[model samples]
Target: MAVLLHLDSSLFPLENSGSRQLTDAFRRTWQEAHPQGSVIYRDLAADRVPHLDAATVAADTLPPLRRQLIAEFEKADVVLIGAPMYNFTVPSTLKAWLDQIILAGRTFGEGVPASGKRVVVASSRGGSYRPGTPRAGFEFDTNYLEKVLGDALGLRVEVITRELTLAPVTPAMAALIPQAEESARQSLLRAAESAREHAALVS
Candidate 1:
Protein backbone atom coordinates (compact mmCIF):
# COMPACT_ATOMS: atom_id res chain seq x y z
CA MET A 1 0.00 0.00 0.00
CA ALA A 2 1.05 3.54 -0.58
CA VAL A 3 2.16 5.65 2.36
CA LEU A 4 1.63 9.37 2.94
CA LEU A 5 3.68 11.31 5.46
CA HIS A 6 1.81 14.40 6.62
CA LEU A 7 3.39 17.14 8.69
CA ASP A 8 1.45 20.05 10.17
CA SER A 9 3.34 23.02 11.63
CA SER A 10 0.58 25.53 12.19
CA LEU A 11 0.56 26.99 15.71
CA PHE A 12 -3.20 27.50 15.77
CA PRO A 13 -5.91 24.88 15.99
CA LEU A 14 -7.86 23.60 12.96
CA GLU A 15 -10.73 26.06 13.37
CA ASN A 16 -8.39 29.01 13.21
CA SER A 17 -5.68 27.77 10.88
CA GLY A 18 -5.85 28.20 7.09
CA SER A 19 -2.91 25.92 6.41
CA ARG A 20 -4.51 23.14 8.45
CA GLN A 21 -7.71 23.41 6.47
CA LEU A 22 -5.84 23.22 3.16
CA THR A 23 -3.83 20.21 4.26
CA ASP A 24 -6.92 18.51 5.65
CA ALA A 25 -8.65 18.94 2.32
CA PHE A 26 -5.71 17.35 0.58
CA ARG A 27 -5.59 14.49 3.07
CA ARG A 28 -9.26 13.77 2.75
CA THR A 29 -9.07 13.68 -1.02
CA TRP A 30 -5.98 11.52 -0.91
CA GLN A 31 -7.72 9.08 1.43
CA GLU A 32 -10.67 8.84 -0.88
CA ALA A 33 -8.41 8.14 -3.82
CA HIS A 34 -6.33 5.56 -1.98
CA PRO A 35 -8.73 3.70 0.26
CA GLN A 36 -6.13 1.31 1.61
CA GLY A 37 -3.16 3.65 1.77
CA SER A 38 -1.55 4.43 5.11
CA VAL A 39 -1.07 7.91 6.56
CA ILE A 40 1.65 8.92 9.00
CA TYR A 41 0.92 12.25 10.65
CA ARG A 42 2.97 14.61 12.78
CA ASP A 43 1.84 17.83 14.44
CA LEU A 44 5.16 19.58 14.71
CA ALA A 45 4.04 22.43 16.92
CA ALA A 46 2.79 20.03 19.58
CA ASP A 47 5.68 17.59 19.23
CA ARG A 48 8.57 19.61 17.97
CA VAL A 49 11.76 17.96 16.84
CA PRO A 50 14.87 19.29 18.50
CA HIS A 51 16.91 21.76 16.50
CA LEU A 52 20.06 20.23 15.05
CA ASP A 53 22.96 20.46 17.47
CA ALA A 54 26.70 19.91 17.40
CA ALA A 55 26.25 16.44 18.84
CA THR A 56 23.91 15.42 16.01
CA VAL A 57 26.30 16.80 13.43
CA ALA A 58 29.57 15.52 14.91
CA ALA A 59 28.46 12.12 16.16
CA ASP A 60 30.11 9.06 14.64
CA THR A 61 26.72 7.37 14.42
CA LEU A 62 23.34 8.72 13.44
CA PRO A 63 21.11 9.70 16.32
CA PRO A 64 18.12 7.37 16.82
CA LEU A 65 15.55 10.08 16.18
CA ARG A 66 17.34 11.35 13.11
CA ARG A 67 17.61 7.84 11.74
CA GLN A 68 13.93 7.27 12.34
CA LEU A 69 12.98 10.53 10.69
CA ILE A 70 15.01 9.69 7.61
CA ALA A 71 13.51 6.24 7.42
CA GLU A 72 10.02 7.65 7.61
CA PHE A 73 10.77 10.13 4.84
CA GLU A 74 12.19 7.44 2.60
CA LYS A 75 9.17 5.25 3.18
CA ALA A 76 6.67 7.86 2.13
CA ASP A 77 5.12 7.75 -1.31
CA VAL A 78 3.90 11.30 -0.79
CA VAL A 79 4.56 14.06 1.73
CA LEU A 80 1.98 16.69 2.69
CA ILE A 81 3.13 19.67 4.72
CA GLY A 82 1.04 22.46 6.24
CA ALA A 83 3.44 25.37 6.45
CA PRO A 84 2.02 28.64 7.69
CA MET A 85 4.52 31.42 7.27
CA TYR A 86 5.62 32.94 10.52
CA ASN A 87 7.71 36.10 10.40
CA PHE A 88 8.09 35.66 6.64
CA THR A 89 9.48 32.15 7.01
CA VAL A 90 8.50 28.62 7.91
CA PRO A 91 7.73 27.77 11.51
CA SER A 92 10.78 26.85 13.56
CA THR A 93 9.31 23.42 14.25
CA LEU A 94 9.18 22.67 10.52
CA LYS A 95 12.77 23.78 10.18
CA ALA A 96 13.75 21.42 12.98
CA TRP A 97 12.05 18.52 11.21
CA LEU A 98 13.87 19.36 7.99
CA ASP A 99 17.18 19.39 9.85
CA GLN A 100 16.48 15.86 11.08
CA ILE A 101 15.63 14.26 7.75
CA ILE A 102 17.99 15.99 5.34
CA LEU A 103 20.96 13.64 5.65
CA ALA A 104 23.62 14.70 3.18
CA GLY A 105 24.72 11.33 1.87
CA ARG A 106 21.33 9.76 2.16
CA THR A 107 18.30 11.95 1.43
CA PHE A 108 20.19 14.78 -0.22
CA GLY A 109 23.44 14.14 -2.11
CA GLU A 110 24.27 11.82 -5.01
CA GLY A 111 21.67 9.06 -5.43
CA VAL A 112 19.13 11.01 -3.39
CA PRO A 113 16.73 8.54 -1.80
CA ALA A 114 13.83 10.96 -1.90
CA SER A 115 14.15 11.85 -5.56
CA GLY A 116 10.87 12.04 -7.52
CA LYS A 117 8.63 11.76 -4.47
CA ARG A 118 5.73 14.24 -4.46
CA VAL A 119 5.54 16.82 -1.66
CA VAL A 120 2.53 19.10 -1.63
CA VAL A 121 2.98 22.08 0.63
CA ALA A 122 -0.08 23.97 1.88
CA SER A 123 1.54 27.36 2.32
CA SER A 124 -0.34 30.20 4.00
CA ARG A 125 0.95 33.71 4.54
CA GLY A 126 -0.50 36.88 6.05
CA GLY A 127 0.12 39.07 3.00
CA SER A 128 0.44 38.77 -0.75
CA TYR A 129 3.72 37.40 -1.99
CA ARG A 130 3.10 36.67 -5.63
CA PRO A 131 5.39 38.29 -8.15
CA GLY A 132 4.55 42.00 -8.61
CA THR A 133 3.11 42.25 -5.11
CA PRO A 134 4.72 44.86 -2.85
CA ARG A 135 5.91 42.23 -0.38
CA ALA A 136 6.90 39.63 -2.97
CA GLY A 137 10.56 39.98 -2.11
CA PHE A 138 9.80 39.16 1.51
CA GLU A 139 8.53 35.67 0.66
CA PHE A 140 10.89 33.08 2.01
CA ASP A 141 8.63 30.27 3.10
CA THR A 142 7.56 28.62 -0.18
CA ASN A 143 10.63 29.73 -2.08
CA TYR A 144 12.88 28.28 0.57
CA LEU A 145 10.97 25.01 0.58
CA GLU A 146 11.13 24.77 -3.20
CA LYS A 147 14.90 25.03 -3.02
CA VAL A 148 15.49 22.77 -0.03
CA LEU A 149 12.91 20.12 -0.79
CA GLY A 150 13.14 20.25 -4.57
CA ASP A 151 16.52 21.55 -5.68
CA ALA A 152 18.50 20.09 -2.79
CA LEU A 153 16.60 16.95 -1.78
CA GLY A 154 15.18 16.17 -5.25
CA LEU A 155 11.58 15.91 -4.14
CA ARG A 156 8.86 17.13 -6.52
CA VAL A 157 7.55 20.22 -4.77
CA GLU A 158 4.08 21.65 -5.36
CA VAL A 159 2.77 24.57 -3.34
CA ILE A 160 -0.80 25.76 -2.85
CA THR A 161 -0.70 29.24 -1.41
CA ARG A 162 -3.29 31.05 0.69
CA GLU A 163 -2.46 34.71 1.17
CA LEU A 164 -3.84 37.78 2.91
CA THR A 165 -4.83 35.59 5.83
CA LEU A 166 -4.53 38.49 8.27
CA ALA A 167 -7.27 40.37 6.54
CA PRO A 168 -9.96 38.89 8.72
CA VAL A 169 -8.38 40.06 11.92
CA THR A 170 -6.42 43.16 11.03
CA PRO A 171 -8.49 46.33 10.78
CA ALA A 172 -6.19 47.85 8.18
CA MET A 173 -6.61 44.79 5.95
CA ALA A 174 -10.43 44.88 6.01
CA ALA A 175 -10.63 45.85 2.35
CA LEU A 176 -8.88 42.64 1.37
CA ILE A 177 -11.11 40.28 3.29
CA PRO A 178 -12.93 39.17 0.15
CA GLN A 179 -9.69 38.39 -1.57
CA ALA A 180 -8.56 36.41 1.45
CA GLU A 181 -11.74 34.33 1.40
CA GLU A 182 -11.32 33.64 -2.30
CA SER A 183 -7.72 32.68 -1.84
CA ALA A 184 -8.69 30.24 0.88
CA ARG A 185 -11.46 28.72 -1.21
CA GLN A 186 -9.16 28.31 -4.17
CA SER A 187 -6.45 26.79 -2.03
CA LEU A 188 -8.80 24.12 -0.71
CA LEU A 189 -9.84 23.25 -4.25
CA ARG A 190 -6.28 23.11 -5.44
CA ALA A 191 -5.30 20.88 -2.54
CA ALA A 192 -7.96 18.32 -3.34
CA GLU A 193 -7.19 18.39 -7.05
CA SER A 194 -3.50 17.97 -6.46
CA ALA A 195 -4.05 15.11 -4.02
CA ARG A 196 -6.17 13.17 -6.44
CA GLU A 197 -3.73 13.76 -9.27
CA HIS A 198 -0.83 12.51 -7.19
CA ALA A 199 -2.75 9.57 -5.76
CA ALA A 200 -3.34 8.30 -9.29
CA LEU A 201 0.41 7.89 -9.72
CA VAL A 202 0.98 5.95 -6.46
CA SER A 203 0.46 2.56 -7.98
Candidate 2:
Protein backbone atom coordinates (compact mmCIF):
# COMPACT_ATOMS: atom_id res chain seq x y z
CA MET A 1 0.00 0.00 0.00
CA ALA A 2 1.17 3.55 -0.70
CA VAL A 3 2.23 5.48 2.38
CA LEU A 4 1.71 9.22 2.74
CA LEU A 5 3.29 11.35 5.42
CA HIS A 6 1.01 14.31 6.13
CA LEU A 7 2.44 17.24 8.07
CA ASP A 8 0.73 20.32 9.46
CA SER A 9 2.58 23.36 10.81
CA SER A 10 -0.20 25.84 11.38
CA LEU A 11 -0.22 27.75 14.66
CA PHE A 12 -3.94 28.53 14.52
CA PRO A 13 -7.05 26.43 14.75
CA LEU A 14 -7.73 24.21 11.75
CA GLU A 15 -10.99 25.98 10.84
CA ASN A 16 -9.19 29.31 10.67
CA SER A 17 -6.21 28.00 8.74
CA GLY A 18 -5.78 28.20 4.98
CA SER A 19 -2.82 25.84 4.73
CA ARG A 20 -4.63 23.25 6.82
CA GLN A 21 -7.69 23.49 4.59
CA LEU A 22 -5.66 23.08 1.43
CA THR A 23 -3.81 20.02 2.71
CA ASP A 24 -7.03 18.55 4.00
CA ALA A 25 -8.52 18.92 0.53
CA PHE A 26 -5.72 16.86 -0.97
CA ARG A 27 -5.89 14.19 1.76
CA ARG A 28 -9.63 13.74 1.37
CA THR A 29 -9.42 13.24 -2.38
CA TRP A 30 -6.37 11.04 -2.11
CA GLN A 31 -7.97 8.81 0.53
CA GLU A 32 -11.15 8.56 -1.52
CA ALA A 33 -9.12 7.27 -4.44
CA HIS A 34 -6.79 5.10 -2.43
CA PRO A 35 -9.07 3.56 0.14
CA GLN A 36 -6.47 1.26 1.60
CA GLY A 37 -3.57 3.65 1.58
CA SER A 38 -2.04 4.71 4.91
CA VAL A 39 -1.56 8.25 6.13
CA ILE A 40 0.81 9.29 8.94
CA TYR A 41 -0.09 12.65 10.38
CA ARG A 42 2.34 14.99 12.14
CA ASP A 43 1.25 18.24 13.72
CA LEU A 44 4.34 20.34 14.19
CA ALA A 45 2.73 23.12 16.16
CA ALA A 46 1.37 20.72 18.73
CA ASP A 47 4.50 18.59 18.91
CA ARG A 48 7.43 20.61 17.77
CA VAL A 49 10.68 18.89 16.92
CA PRO A 50 13.66 20.08 18.87
CA HIS A 51 15.93 22.47 17.08
CA LEU A 52 19.07 20.92 15.67
CA ASP A 53 22.15 21.41 17.78
CA ALA A 54 25.94 21.06 17.63
CA ALA A 55 25.74 17.54 19.01
CA THR A 56 23.39 16.55 16.21
CA VAL A 57 25.75 18.00 13.63
CA ALA A 58 29.00 16.74 15.07
CA ALA A 59 28.00 13.19 15.95
CA ASP A 60 27.41 10.38 13.53
CA THR A 61 24.41 9.20 15.53
CA LEU A 62 21.17 11.12 15.35
CA PRO A 63 18.84 12.14 18.15
CA PRO A 64 15.89 9.83 18.88
CA LEU A 65 13.32 12.21 17.42
CA ARG A 66 15.35 12.87 14.31
CA ARG A 67 15.98 9.19 13.76
CA GLN A 68 12.29 8.50 13.96
CA LEU A 69 11.52 11.39 11.60
CA ILE A 70 14.08 10.22 9.06
CA ALA A 71 12.72 6.70 9.20
CA GLU A 72 9.19 7.90 8.58
CA PHE A 73 10.34 10.07 5.69
CA GLU A 74 12.25 7.21 4.11
CA LYS A 75 9.18 5.00 4.28
CA ALA A 76 6.79 7.52 2.79
CA ASP A 77 5.97 7.24 -0.89
CA VAL A 78 4.32 10.65 -0.74
CA VAL A 79 4.78 13.64 1.57
CA LEU A 80 2.07 16.25 2.15
CA ILE A 81 2.92 19.42 4.02
CA GLY A 82 0.79 22.30 5.33
CA ALA A 83 3.20 25.18 5.76
CA PRO A 84 1.86 28.44 7.17
CA MET A 85 4.24 31.30 6.58
CA TYR A 86 5.51 32.95 9.78
CA ASN A 87 7.58 36.06 10.12
CA PHE A 88 8.69 36.16 6.48
CA THR A 89 9.45 32.42 6.45
CA VAL A 90 8.18 28.97 7.22
CA PRO A 91 7.37 28.09 10.82
CA SER A 92 10.45 27.28 12.89
CA THR A 93 9.05 23.84 13.62
CA LEU A 94 8.91 23.05 9.94
CA LYS A 95 12.49 24.19 9.56
CA ALA A 96 13.53 21.89 12.39
CA TRP A 97 11.83 18.95 10.69
CA LEU A 98 13.55 19.71 7.40
CA ASP A 99 16.91 19.98 9.11
CA GLN A 100 16.48 16.39 10.32
CA ILE A 101 15.52 15.13 6.87
CA ILE A 102 18.55 16.59 5.13
CA LEU A 103 20.86 13.99 6.61
CA ALA A 104 24.39 13.64 5.41
CA GLY A 105 25.01 9.95 4.72
CA ARG A 106 21.50 8.59 5.17
CA THR A 107 19.40 10.82 2.92
CA PHE A 108 22.22 12.23 0.78
CA GLY A 109 25.84 11.42 0.16
CA GLU A 110 28.14 9.93 -2.47
CA GLY A 111 26.51 6.98 -4.23
CA VAL A 112 23.14 7.87 -2.60
CA PRO A 113 21.49 8.42 -5.99
CA ALA A 114 18.90 10.99 -4.87
CA SER A 115 15.65 10.26 -2.98
CA GLY A 116 13.42 10.86 -6.04
CA LYS A 117 10.41 11.01 -3.72
CA ARG A 118 7.34 13.13 -4.36
CA VAL A 119 6.21 15.96 -2.08
CA VAL A 120 3.26 18.36 -2.17
CA VAL A 121 3.37 21.56 -0.17
CA ALA A 122 0.17 23.42 0.68
CA SER A 123 1.26 26.86 1.81
CA SER A 124 -0.43 30.05 3.02
CA ARG A 125 0.74 33.63 3.38
CA GLY A 126 -1.06 36.40 5.28
CA GLY A 127 -0.09 39.22 2.93
CA SER A 128 0.17 39.78 -0.82
CA TYR A 129 3.53 38.84 -2.29
CA ARG A 130 2.84 38.05 -5.88
CA PRO A 131 5.44 39.05 -8.43
CA GLY A 132 5.63 42.84 -9.08
CA THR A 133 4.02 43.45 -5.70
CA PRO A 134 6.12 45.59 -3.33
CA ARG A 135 6.98 42.52 -1.24
CA ALA A 136 7.43 40.41 -4.36
CA GLY A 137 10.67 38.65 -3.56
CA PHE A 138 10.08 38.74 0.19
CA GLU A 139 8.49 35.32 0.14
CA PHE A 140 10.97 32.99 1.81
CA ASP A 141 8.86 30.01 2.82
CA THR A 142 7.64 28.31 -0.38
CA ASN A 143 10.78 29.08 -2.36
CA TYR A 144 13.02 27.71 0.38
CA LEU A 145 10.84 24.62 0.68
CA GLU A 146 11.01 24.05 -3.06
CA LYS A 147 14.77 24.22 -3.09
CA VAL A 148 15.27 21.95 -0.08
CA LEU A 149 12.68 19.39 -1.10
CA GLY A 150 13.87 19.42 -4.72
CA ASP A 151 17.57 20.16 -4.83
CA ALA A 152 18.80 18.96 -1.44
CA LEU A 153 16.49 15.98 -0.97
CA GLY A 154 16.07 15.18 -4.66
CA LEU A 155 12.30 15.08 -4.35
CA ARG A 156 9.82 16.08 -7.05
CA VAL A 157 8.01 18.83 -5.15
CA GLU A 158 4.69 20.31 -6.22
CA VAL A 159 3.49 23.43 -4.40
CA ILE A 160 0.12 25.20 -4.06
CA THR A 161 0.08 28.48 -2.15
CA ARG A 162 -2.74 30.80 -1.00
CA GLU A 163 -1.86 34.42 -0.34
CA LEU A 164 -3.49 37.40 1.38
CA THR A 165 -4.95 35.00 3.88
CA LEU A 166 -5.46 37.74 6.50
CA ALA A 167 -8.06 39.54 4.44
CA PRO A 168 -10.94 38.63 6.71
CA VAL A 169 -9.63 40.67 9.63
CA THR A 170 -7.01 43.07 8.34
CA PRO A 171 -8.70 46.36 7.49
CA ALA A 172 -6.18 47.34 4.85
CA MET A 173 -6.42 43.96 3.15
CA ALA A 174 -10.23 43.78 3.40
CA ALA A 175 -10.51 45.11 -0.17
CA LEU A 176 -8.57 42.13 -1.53
CA ILE A 177 -10.72 39.51 0.20
CA PRO A 178 -12.23 38.38 -3.08
CA GLN A 179 -8.84 37.80 -4.58
CA ALA A 180 -7.81 35.86 -1.49
CA GLU A 181 -10.87 33.66 -1.76
CA GLU A 182 -10.13 33.05 -5.41
CA SER A 183 -6.56 32.11 -4.58
CA ALA A 184 -7.81 29.62 -2.00
CA ARG A 185 -10.30 28.12 -4.47
CA GLN A 186 -7.55 27.76 -7.05
CA SER A 187 -5.25 26.19 -4.48
CA LEU A 188 -7.88 23.65 -3.49
CA LEU A 189 -8.38 22.76 -7.15
CA ARG A 190 -4.65 22.31 -7.60
CA ALA A 191 -4.45 20.17 -4.48
CA ALA A 192 -7.19 17.86 -5.72
CA GLU A 193 -5.59 17.67 -9.13
CA SER A 194 -2.18 16.85 -7.70
CA ALA A 195 -3.65 14.26 -5.36
CA ARG A 196 -5.33 12.55 -8.29
CA GLU A 197 -2.14 12.64 -10.28
CA HIS A 198 -0.24 11.10 -7.39
CA ALA A 199 -2.91 8.45 -6.85
CA ALA A 200 -2.67 7.45 -10.50
CA LEU A 201 1.07 6.96 -10.15
CA VAL A 202 0.82 4.85 -7.00
CA SER A 203 -2.54 3.15 -7.29
Candidate 3:
Protein backbone atom coordinates (compact mmCIF):
# COMPACT_ATOMS: atom_id res chain seq x y z
CA MET A 1 0.00 0.00 0.00
CA ALA A 2 1.11 3.57 -0.61
CA VAL A 3 2.12 5.63 2.42
CA LEU A 4 1.13 9.22 3.19
CA LEU A 5 3.10 11.04 5.88
CA HIS A 6 1.02 13.66 7.65
CA LEU A 7 2.70 16.32 9.76
CA ASP A 8 0.55 18.76 11.70
CA SER A 9 2.32 21.67 13.41
CA SER A 10 -0.70 23.70 14.44
CA LEU A 11 -0.84 24.39 18.17
CA PHE A 12 -4.61 24.82 18.06
CA PRO A 13 -5.61 21.58 16.38
CA LEU A 14 -8.68 21.76 14.16
CA GLU A 15 -10.70 23.91 16.55
CA ASN A 16 -9.14 27.31 16.15
CA SER A 17 -7.05 27.47 12.98
CA GLY A 18 -8.26 27.57 9.43
CA SER A 19 -5.02 25.83 8.46
CA ARG A 20 -5.80 22.69 10.37
CA GLN A 21 -9.29 22.59 8.96
CA LEU A 22 -7.91 22.95 5.49
CA THR A 23 -5.43 20.16 6.09
CA ASP A 24 -8.12 17.89 7.50
CA ALA A 25 -10.21 18.52 4.44
CA PHE A 26 -7.32 17.65 2.23
CA ARG A 27 -6.68 14.49 4.17
CA ARG A 28 -10.24 13.35 3.70
CA THR A 29 -10.13 14.02 -0.01
CA TRP A 30 -6.84 12.21 -0.35
CA GLN A 31 -8.14 9.24 1.59
CA GLU A 32 -11.12 9.07 -0.70
CA ALA A 33 -8.97 9.12 -3.78
CA HIS A 34 -6.48 6.57 -2.46
CA PRO A 35 -8.50 4.29 -0.27
CA GLN A 36 -5.83 1.63 -0.03
CA GLY A 37 -3.18 4.09 1.12
CA SER A 38 -2.09 4.26 4.73
CA VAL A 39 -1.38 7.51 6.59
CA ILE A 40 1.33 8.05 9.21
CA TYR A 41 0.61 11.08 11.36
CA ARG A 42 3.09 13.21 13.28
CA ASP A 43 1.56 15.83 15.53
CA LEU A 44 4.21 18.40 16.26
CA ALA A 45 2.26 20.23 18.94
CA ALA A 46 1.43 17.32 21.18
CA ASP A 47 4.65 15.45 20.56
CA ARG A 48 7.11 18.17 19.78
CA VAL A 49 10.19 17.30 17.78
CA PRO A 50 13.11 19.14 19.29
CA HIS A 51 14.85 21.85 17.35
CA LEU A 52 18.36 21.07 16.13
CA ASP A 53 20.62 21.86 19.03
CA ALA A 54 24.21 21.04 19.76
CA ALA A 55 23.29 17.45 20.54
CA THR A 56 21.02 17.00 17.52
CA VAL A 57 23.53 18.61 15.20
CA ALA A 58 26.12 16.20 16.40
CA ALA A 59 23.72 13.31 16.17
CA ASP A 60 22.82 14.22 12.62
CA THR A 61 26.37 13.66 11.53
CA LEU A 62 26.53 10.27 13.21
CA PRO A 63 25.58 7.16 11.27
CA PRO A 64 22.89 5.99 13.71
CA LEU A 65 20.71 9.08 13.73
CA ARG A 66 21.23 9.62 10.03
CA ARG A 67 20.09 6.10 9.27
CA GLN A 68 17.07 6.36 11.55
CA LEU A 69 15.62 9.49 10.00
CA ILE A 70 16.47 8.37 6.52
CA ALA A 71 14.64 5.11 7.09
CA GLU A 72 11.55 7.05 8.10
CA PHE A 73 11.79 9.37 5.13
CA GLU A 74 12.32 6.56 2.68
CA LYS A 75 9.20 4.70 3.78
CA ALA A 76 6.83 7.44 2.78
CA ASP A 77 5.91 8.23 -0.81
CA VAL A 78 3.86 11.36 -0.03
CA VAL A 79 4.46 14.01 2.65
CA LEU A 80 1.70 16.34 3.86
CA ILE A 81 2.66 19.20 6.15
CA GLY A 82 0.19 21.46 7.95
CA ALA A 83 2.15 24.51 9.05
CA PRO A 84 1.28 27.93 10.37
CA MET A 85 3.43 30.88 9.40
CA TYR A 86 4.79 32.57 12.45
CA ASN A 87 6.25 36.06 12.07
CA PHE A 88 6.72 35.68 8.31
CA THR A 89 8.41 32.28 8.62
CA VAL A 90 7.63 28.66 9.32
CA PRO A 91 6.83 27.77 12.89
CA SER A 92 9.88 26.76 14.87
CA THR A 93 8.38 23.33 15.44
CA LEU A 94 7.98 22.66 11.74
CA LYS A 95 11.50 23.94 11.12
CA ALA A 96 12.76 21.52 13.74
CA TRP A 97 10.91 18.69 12.05
CA LEU A 98 12.45 19.66 8.73
CA ASP A 99 15.89 19.72 10.30
CA GLN A 100 15.53 16.11 11.29
CA ILE A 101 14.45 14.96 7.84
CA ILE A 102 17.02 16.89 5.81
CA LEU A 103 20.22 14.87 5.81
CA ALA A 104 22.76 16.15 3.31
CA GLY A 105 23.80 12.90 1.70
CA ARG A 106 20.69 10.94 2.51
CA THR A 107 17.87 13.08 1.14
CA PHE A 108 20.07 14.54 -1.55
CA GLY A 109 23.52 14.21 -3.01
CA GLU A 110 25.78 15.74 -5.66
CA GLY A 111 24.50 16.26 -9.24
CA VAL A 112 20.95 17.16 -8.26
CA PRO A 113 19.83 13.69 -7.32
CA ALA A 114 16.11 13.17 -6.99
CA SER A 115 14.50 11.49 -3.99
CA GLY A 116 11.45 10.79 -6.16
CA LYS A 117 9.24 12.12 -3.37
CA ARG A 118 6.30 14.55 -3.30
CA VAL A 119 5.56 17.07 -0.53
CA VAL A 120 2.48 19.21 0.08
CA VAL A 121 2.72 22.12 2.50
CA ALA A 122 -0.54 23.52 3.81
CA SER A 123 0.16 26.83 5.56
CA SER A 124 -2.02 29.32 7.38
CA ARG A 125 -1.32 33.00 8.00
CA GLY A 126 -3.11 36.02 9.41
CA GLY A 127 -2.41 38.39 6.54
CA SER A 128 -2.48 38.61 2.77
CA TYR A 129 0.94 37.87 1.34
CA ARG A 130 0.16 36.74 -2.18
CA PRO A 131 2.56 38.01 -4.80
CA GLY A 132 1.83 41.45 -6.26
CA THR A 133 0.24 42.48 -2.97
CA PRO A 134 2.00 45.05 -0.79
CA ARG A 135 2.28 42.54 2.02
CA ALA A 136 3.77 39.89 -0.23
CA GLY A 137 7.09 40.55 1.42
CA PHE A 138 5.84 38.41 4.32
CA GLU A 139 5.95 35.25 2.24
CA PHE A 140 9.27 33.92 3.48
CA ASP A 141 7.67 30.88 5.13
CA THR A 142 6.13 29.31 2.05
CA ASN A 143 9.01 30.31 -0.21
CA TYR A 144 11.62 28.97 2.18
CA LEU A 145 9.79 25.66 2.52
CA GLU A 146 9.56 25.26 -1.24
CA LYS A 147 13.21 26.07 -1.78
CA VAL A 148 14.49 23.88 1.04
CA LEU A 149 12.30 20.84 0.41
CA GLY A 150 12.40 20.99 -3.38
CA ASP A 151 15.90 22.23 -4.10
CA ALA A 152 17.76 20.96 -1.09
CA LEU A 153 15.99 17.65 -0.49
CA GLY A 154 14.94 17.04 -4.09
CA LEU A 155 11.25 16.55 -3.28
CA ARG A 156 8.56 17.80 -5.64
CA VAL A 157 6.70 20.44 -3.59
CA GLU A 158 3.28 22.05 -3.58
CA VAL A 159 1.87 24.74 -1.26
CA ILE A 160 -1.61 25.72 -0.10
CA THR A 161 -1.95 28.88 1.98
CA ARG A 162 -4.90 29.67 4.23
CA GLU A 163 -5.00 33.36 4.99
CA LEU A 164 -7.04 33.95 8.13
CA THR A 165 -6.81 37.72 8.10
CA LEU A 166 -9.31 37.35 10.96
CA ALA A 167 -7.00 37.92 13.89
CA PRO A 168 -6.24 41.55 14.70
CA VAL A 169 -9.42 41.98 12.79
CA THR A 170 -9.87 45.31 11.18
CA PRO A 171 -13.03 45.77 9.12
CA ALA A 172 -11.11 45.17 5.92
CA MET A 173 -9.43 42.07 7.32
CA ALA A 174 -12.76 40.66 8.50
CA ALA A 175 -14.22 41.04 5.06
CA LEU A 176 -11.64 38.77 3.48
CA ILE A 177 -11.93 35.82 5.88
CA PRO A 178 -14.75 33.98 4.14
CA GLN A 179 -13.29 34.27 0.69
CA ALA A 180 -9.85 33.36 1.94
CA GLU A 181 -11.09 30.23 3.68
CA GLU A 182 -12.91 29.17 0.54
CA SER A 183 -9.82 29.71 -1.52
CA ALA A 184 -7.73 27.74 0.92
CA ARG A 185 -10.15 24.83 0.87
CA GLN A 186 -10.07 24.79 -2.91
CA SER A 187 -6.29 24.90 -2.98
CA LEU A 188 -6.14 22.02 -0.54
CA LEU A 189 -8.45 19.93 -2.69
CA ARG A 190 -6.26 20.63 -5.66
CA ALA A 191 -3.20 19.57 -3.72
CA ALA A 192 -4.90 16.35 -2.72
CA GLU A 193 -5.69 15.61 -6.34
CA SER A 194 -2.14 16.34 -7.33
CA ALA A 195 -0.85 14.02 -4.62
CA ARG A 196 -3.14 11.24 -5.80
CA GLU A 197 -1.96 11.62 -9.37
CA HIS A 198 1.67 11.71 -8.32
CA ALA A 199 1.24 8.63 -6.19
CA ALA A 200 -0.29 6.77 -9.11
CA LEU A 201 2.54 7.75 -11.43
CA VAL A 202 5.14 6.64 -8.94
CA SER A 203 3.41 3.37 -8.16
RMSD of each: 1.1, 1.2, 2.7
Candidate 3, residue 193: Cα displacement in angstroms equals: 3.3
Model 2 segments more than 4 A misplaced: none
TM-score of each: 0.97, 0.95, 0.85
Pairs of residues at least 3 apart in sequence or in different chains that clash in candidate 2: none
Q: Report the CA-based lDDT of candidate 3 relative to the real structure.
A: 0.76
Q: Whole-model Cα lDDT per candidate?
A: 0.94, 0.90, 0.76
Clashes of 3: 0
Better of 1 and 3 by lDDT: 1
TM-score of 3: 0.85
Q: Total backbone clashes of model 1?
A: 0
Clashes of 2: 0
lDDT of 1 by residue, 86-170 (tens): 9999999999999999887888888656579999999999889999999889999999999999999988999999999999999
Cα displacement (angstroms), candidate 2, residue 36, comes to 1.1
Question: Which candidate should be chosen as best, given lDDT against the real structure?
Answer: 1
Q: Per-residue lDDT tens digits of candidate 2, residues 1-203?
A: 99999999999887899999999999999998888899999999999988888988888777788889999999999999999889889999999998887887678767678868999999999987778999978889998999888887789999899988999889988899999989988998999999988988888
Sliding window of 10 residues with minimal summed lDDT for model 1: 106-115
TM-score of 2: 0.95
